[model samples]
Target: MIEVRAPEPGDLETIGREAREEWVRDRFRTGVDFSPLMDKPNTHVALIDGQPVAAGGFIDRGNGNAIAWSVLGRVDERHFVGLVRAFRKYMKATPYRWIEAHCIATFHQSHRWVKCLGFVPVNGERCFTPDGREFRKYVFRNHNGS
Candidate 1:
């Protein structure tokens, strides 16, 4: 069974260390600890049979806007889809007027997954990370929010 709950200490680090993407592992190996973020509101960890698989949350950006983020480890298709469903419910109940997520342009799965969560790509929008990697912006507008 899959469980989605508030992240506990070390959840992010555990997920980061086991991230399926090499870039994500490299980021974690740089000594940056994301465990602290678990204390933030909306942050959550996904576990399967007691093993951490993913962690993420929305960071309120004020003015009815927020940023969505997630880090994944090795996850089976079933749990991944379950996480998507949970995220959709969270978005539906959120008070944010807009929630944005940035996807690494080369990560095709991410692009598709964001769409699965109902985020629309911003036309003509392009963003660059501090390391110079290109990214695309996607936004989810909440018609029910202010």
Candidate 2:
């Protein structure tokens, strides 16, 4: 069974490594770093058979809202749904009135998943790749207090 829980300090290295791998595979970019957010109190990890497979976090932007980001691999929909439900509850308990996610257009699965979760597209534009190639930037937002 896959479980979603608060991230621990010891999980930082593993999460960062997986994130870097995903980054390289998805964007053809290496040397990417996630140290800035690892071990942050707001981050969470998804564990399957006791191994970390996905991770994400939120930044409290004040004003009863927060900006959120997540990284996922090919995972089961059941697990993903559970994580979203948990995160929704987390948002409600905190001061956050909204949660936002920015995704690369190349990640079609991600875009579909976010839309399924009721995240409305607020805006989109071209984002430059490391090699100067342009990709679409999709911004999704979920309002909670409404």
Candidate 3:
């Protein structure tokens, strides 16, 4: 069973340990120390059988726009779907006007996901990280509470 809950201290290491995908490793900012993100606000963790499997957070970018990011340990539909739903819930509650998500264009699954969940493409701009890998960005608007 998969459970999604608030992030705990030092859980990032567990997620890192479970992650072995090449793209997942490349998804992180190059040369940036990630230890400080363990306590980052608005972050969450997905656990299966009491072990952390994925972790991520949202960063507020002023002017009612924010960005969301996540790293996974394993690919499981139930867990991924839960995370997406939680993201939608957060968008609905927060005052942020929009939230942006970026992923490598080669990552077809993620590209499809952000699209399925209503993240619109923004001018088809491609971005590059410090490591020089190209990426695509998607934006999701915060919906009015209904």
Candidate 4:
């Protein structure tokens, strides 16, 4: 069973140990650290049978907008759908009216997953990270929320 809860200090390290090489390299090159996120409000970890599979949350950009970020560990294919459902549930529970996320333009699976979580691609808003990888912007907007 996958249980989503507040992140523990070691969760990031645990995930890093089994994360994909490309992801680890990108993080290192971009200086994308998850340590500070552990201190952020609403951050969470998804644990399957007491083992963390993922951790992520929102970083407030103010004015009802926030940046969404997450890190993944070695995940079982069977648990993919469940994890997506958990992510959607957590996203909806947040107070932010606009949530923004970015994914590598070449990673098709990532694009699909974010869309499944209710994010839509931002037209013509491509960005490049420090590593020179092209990324596409995605946003989740709650028009009915304040």
Question: Best candidate, TM-score-wise?
Answer: 1
Candidate 2 per-residue C-alpha lDDT over 65-146 given as tens digits, one digit per residue, 9 for 90 to 100? 6666666554555676776665555544544566766556666766765665556676545566577654444333434443
**lDDT against true structure, model 1:** 0.83
Per-residue alpha-carbon lDDT of model 3 for 1-36, expressed as tens digits? 667678876566667656766655653525446756
Off by over 4 Å in 3: 23-32
Strongest candidate by lDDT:
4
Model 3, residue 139: displacement in angstroms? 0.2
Better of 1 and 3 by TM-score: 1
Badly placed stretches (over 4 Å) of model 4 are: 25-33, 143-145
What TM-score do all the candidates reach, one by one?
Answer: 0.90, 0.65, 0.77, 0.87
Winner of 2 and 4 under lDDT: 4
Off by over 4 Å in 1: 144-146
> 96, model 1: CA deviation in Å?
1.1
Give residue 140's error in model 2 in angstroms: 7.1
Q: What would the per-residue lDDT of candidate 1 be over residues 1-146, giving only the tens digit for each residue?
A: 77888887778878888977888889888988575567778777878899988877888899999988888788888777787887677677777889999998998878987898899999797799899999999999988766
User: Which scores better on lDDT, 1 or 2?
Assistant: 1
Task: Give the per-residue lDDT of model 4 (tens digit) for 14-115.
Answer: 776667657664654564666788889879999989999888899998898988988777888999889999998888888889999999888776788789
